[model samples]
Target: MRESLRLLRDELSRINSPDELSSWKERFEELLREAVEKKLGVKCRSPVYLFKTLYHAGFINREELDALLQFDELNDPSFFERLLERLETRL
Candidate 1:
């Protein structure tokens, strides 16, 4: 997970336009889902933290964030709510 995030960060640094950033949104979402699934058993906070980091870094905008949150695989409304609350505070 840390390695994936590192790769994402490195890729983000190379983004030269809005198009490039837009292209990465799905990759970020995939990473979030994978991280969440891998850590689901342990109740790890990595997924939320990764979202926050991507958001703060401008790798994703509000719309993308919402889209990512809409993932049904999470199957946890409270977790989504908590992440939404965290995002609101950051905004």
Candidate 2:
């Protein structure tokens, strides 16, 4: 999960404000679900819990975490990875 955490760290750094960070939570949630499923080889029953795990693991802060879970968005893994890469450097 080192790669995943690294990716999350990169993504978090890209967040310019709490607002944008919140928006990303939804997308990040989806990404987290997919990753969890792939890594565990099973479907996750609780997306909320999964999101919380990711949040606590360093994907985002409390304010943005709430927003991201509340927001709705599509998942673009490539874009997400790129965002993470950009944010990592910025951070």
- Residue 34 CA displacement from its true place in model 1, Å: 0.5
Candidate 1 runs further than 4 Å off: 41-91
Q: Summarize candidate 2's per-residue lDDT along 1-91 as a digit string, tens digits.
A: 4466476756666777667766766555556677656654545567667656556656556754574464445233454555455434322
lDDT of each: 0.54, 0.56
List the candidates' TM-scores in order: 0.46, 0.41
Specify the poorest-scoring 10-residue window by lDDT in model 1. 72-81
Model 2 is weakest, by summed lDDT over 10 consecutive residues, at 82-91
Residue lDDT tens for model 1, 1-91: 6666656666666777656665665575566656554654323355566555555556457765665555434433334345434433432
lDDT of 2: 0.56
What TM-score does structure 2 among the candidates reach? Answer: 0.41
User: Which candidate has the top score in TM-score?
Assistant: 1
Model 2 regions lying over 4 Å from their true place:
1-5, 49-91
